[model samples]
Target: MWHTVVGAVGLVMGLLPHVLHHIGLLAGTAFVAGSGGTALFGALGLLASVPMLIRLYRRFGSWVAPAVGLLVFAAMFSLSAFVIGPAISGAEGDVTTPSPAPAVDHTDHPGH
Candidate 1:
């Protein structure tokens, strides 16, 4: 019973981000645009998976532990992409690229 609930929660939690991204509310391109509430939603979705992770740990023991870690990492990445991606995109103009250095005229140097 609880397992089913956990599974349902996990499924919904995992799918919500994809749905938002597909709908264009979440950041799919720019990072900062989705860095607001959408990022929070994604983080909440990951936190909601803790119960399912516990269930998995009990069922599969140590073997599935790594998988759980990977899931957490994936969740963090998704949230970061949605949140940071747009902010970075918006800040692209603030980043200054290095200009090419001018050639020195060595012919006028005493050591030349």
Candidate 2:
């Protein structure tokens, strides 16, 4: 029960920043990316832990509950790193406008 609740909370925490970003209320793209990463890991952690918890309760009674929790947190301890993939920085630096050509020196030209 505790593990499920914690997982759910983590998922919600991850989703909030994204929701704000999607609605245009938030600025920085990095934040959105971070939040997305958090959500993925949290949700996955929750999913992976539930079955473990159930199995622990059935077999080890109270002895294995802590272990199950540790496993769940351990799984979550890094989805932000491996599972989320590399961090995405903001837009690349590329000029939108072309530079103007140098003006011809017609005034000094004999032909002019």
Candidate 3:
């Protein structure tokens, strides 16, 4: 009973960030844009969910709870990344335009 409730809560919590990001309420960080940083961020999320996973494990007394948790995370991530995000923000996602290049200085040039 408690496990089911925890799993449902976990699913909703996991989906929250995606919903926020898709709706432009959340901003992306440069660190998370890099490959290594992305991995680190994922690891951090996993670590953060450890307590919930533990509770699920204790209740189920098997690997099923943890597996379900992982699946829920993946499903939420994919649903947002592929479907909701594109629908809300378009196919380009939350891309920002690049800033203009700085003007070149001509004072130091002898020809100038």
| Model 2 lDDT per residue over 1-112, tens place | 9888877776875676457567554453444455575565556666656666777777777856857687757665664444544434332322346779998777887876
Candidate 1 Cα deviation (angstroms), residue 102: 28
Give the number of the best model, judged by TM-score: 3
Clashes of each: 6, 0, 0
TM-score of each model, in listed order: 0.37, 0.33, 0.45
58-92 in candidate 3: lDDT tens per residue? 99999898999988976776675567756874555
> How far does residue 39 in candidate 3 sit from its true spot (Å)?
5.1
Worst 10 residues of 2 by lDDT: 86-95
Q: Which stretches of candidate 1 lie over 4 Å from their true place?
A: 1-33, 63-69, 72-112
Candidate 1 residue lDDT tens string, 1-112:
9778878877887676556556554354343233465567656855775665676788778746858666777877775665575575565433578999998888987976
Clashes of 1: 6
lDDT of each: 0.64, 0.61, 0.66
Q: Is candidate 1 or candidate 3 better by TM-score?
A: 3
Q: Give the TM-score of candidate 1.
A: 0.37
Give the Cα error of residue 91 in candidate 2, in Å. 14
